[model samples]
Target: MILVTGATGSIGRPLVRRLRRDGTAVRALVRDEAKGRALGCEFVVGDFDDPASIVAALAGVDRLLLNGAGALPADGEQPMVRQQKTIIDAALDAGVERVVKVSVWHAAEGGRLAEGAHWEIERHLKASGLSWSILQPNGFMQNFITGQGSFTADGNLVGAYGDGAVSYIDCADIAACAATLLTGPPRDGETFLLSGPQALTHTQIAEKLSAALGRTVHYVSLTADDMAAALISQGLAPRFADDVAVLTQGLASGIAAPTTTAVRDLTGRAPRTFDEFLAAHHEALAALAWAPSR
Candidate 1:
């Protein structure tokens, strides 16, 4: 049996569907009973913060898809660093044969924000006796339509990327990779860097949005300092805001320029292009065109 954590999330929901369609027995770990039932698969209520719950959930599960919320404010520390570490410990104890985790691009020791948090968890997972495959993916293409990173309050394409291209990818592709890893033979200790078919700058992205939305959308560039201030204005801690600003500025240097063949190599097809992503998510993007700007 395979246990999928964060099963209600963008990647996990689709992953569960794909696994079930492919005839794999799957269970979702959820915090809410209703959510668990809605998954249409066997599921158990569990929380990363509750170690005992995890132990019970992992019982009889040989493979684990480890994923959860990203960096959150916790007295200037990333809670995921501790939260995922706890899951890693429980997975180890459960005798899970293999674990697949979602990480971020540019993840490394001492890297800023989620990069550092994911790196620390990756280290722990590697040290554990369980086999592991880490998926380090670039920005999610869903961000544009989901109000993740694409807009300012006035509905402009907001970013700190100064004409640099980001190889954004679809979470579906990421989920496909995870399903393959969980169901197939173990590719232990391997880290796959996933990206879209091509790199596109903020200007190009805005143009795509315009064409898709049938309205004029503009790219508004913010400096590193500007991004930090905006985060602070949004009630983020100043220190955390500054740290995110550092990562945002790093994007200006083409940090996500390289498009790797890892996704195709693992999933047996080329990753979706940005245009294809927009096309696949046309209705959602179109809805955004009419919604009130945040």
Candidate 2:
């Protein structure tokens, strides 16, 4: 049996569906029964914060997908560092044979935000004596639909990325890779760097949104300080918001511009382009276009 954490999330939802469609025995680790039922699969109520719950959820499960929420605005270490490490320890004790973890690009020591958090978890997972593969993906294309750190109060695309482009992989593609790793021959101890087929600037992304949403979506470029101040006004912790802005500024240097063939190599198909992502998520984009911006 395979256990999928973060089953309700963008990547996990698709992974569960694909596994079930392929007739694999899969169970989702959800925080509540309602969410478990909503997933329409075998599931257990569990939280990463609760060690007993995680141990129970790992019963009879051989392979696991280690995924969850990202960095939060809390002070000190990111909660995911602790949460995922706990899961790793439990997975080890539970005798799970393999794990596929979702990590972020540029995960390294002392890196800001998710980078540092994922680095810590990666280290723990590597030393846990469990067979593991890590997926280090670029920005998610779903960020546009969810408006996560990508939109302003007026619904305009806002960022510190000037003209540099980001290769935002679709979550569905990431899920496909996970499905392959979970069900196919093990590529243990391998780290895959995933990205979309092409890199796109936020300005180009806004134009695509304009075409898809049938509205004139604009790109509002800001310096790191300006973006940090705006995020602080939204009630984010000053330190957290400033860190986010600093990370965004790094994107301006084209650090995340390169595209990779990892997705295609794993899934046996090319990753979706930005246009295809927009098309696949048409209804969500429509809703986003009409929703109140924050």
Candidate 3:
């Protein structure tokens, strides 16, 4: 049986749905039973924070998809890394055949916080002696709609990216890639850098959003301090907001502005464009308003 963790998240949710549609037997590990039941998969109650629960969740599983829920803190307990080690340990102990993991682009080269954690996880996975594939996808297009990259205000797109370009693949494309790797032949110790068809800057993204929504939207650049303050005002922890500002600074330096063929190479088609993502999520964008009460 195939096991998926973080099954209710952006990629995992769609991954589970696609797997079910493909008639694959799937088991989902969730911290909440209610959410697990809603996924329409064989459900197990577990949290990566609890290694015993994670071990219990892996029973009878031959293949595993390792996905973490959020970015790891720069200095802390490193919950994501700990959880990944726990899962890999359990997988090795259980003799699971293949493991597919979601990592960040340039994780092996490593400087970003997420990249560092992924690098460590990749090292552990490789040493586990199991067939494995690491999917290192670039920035996600869904981040734009989810308030991580940009937000709408009177039909305007506001973000900290300025004019820096990024190849943002849709989360569904990431899922399709993951499903292919999980269900296909065992690719031992392979890494894939998934990206969209083309690289786009914030201005280009705004234009696409404008065209897709049939409204005039412009991209407004914000200073890192300003962005951090805004995010803090929106209820993100001050330290986390500062880290986000740092990440945006890294993006602005052009580190994240590159295109890759891994998505198309694996999926047999080009990844979804920003316009495609805008068309699909236009309504949700239109309905969102910056309510400080949220």
Query: What tens digits encode model 2's per-residue C-alpha lDDT throughout 214-265?
Result: 8999999999999989877766667778888898889989999999999989
Candidate 3 residue runs with Cα over 4 Å from true position: 72-77, 108-110, 152-155, 289-294
> What is each predicted model's overall lDDT from 0 to 1?
0.86, 0.90, 0.81
Which residue pairs collide in model 2, if any? none
Shift of residue 287 alpha carbon in model 1, Å: 3.2
List the candidates' TM-scores in order: 0.94, 0.96, 0.91
Query: In terms of TM-score, which candidate is stronger, 2 or 3?
Result: 2
Candidate 1 lDDT score at position 270: 95
Off by over 4 Å in 1: 74-76, 147-149, 235-237, 292-294
Task: Evaluate residue 244 in candidate 1 and report its C-alpha lDDT on the 0 to 100 scale.
Answer: 69
TM-score of 1: 0.94
Model 1 residue 177 distance off true place after TM-score fit, in angstroms: 0.5
Report the Cα lDDT for candidate 3: 0.81
lDDT of candidate 3 over 84-152, digit per residue (tens) = 988999988887889999988878545545777788888988888888999999988877656543563
**1-294 in candidate 1: lDDT tens per residue?**
999999998789999999989889999999999988988999999898888999999999999999987645636766788888888888888888999999999888988778888989898988887899999999888777763445666666876778788899999999999999999888999999999889999999999988887888899899889987876776667777787677767878897888999999999999988888888899877776556243
Scored by TM-score, the top model is 2
Query: Model 2 clash tally?
Result: 0
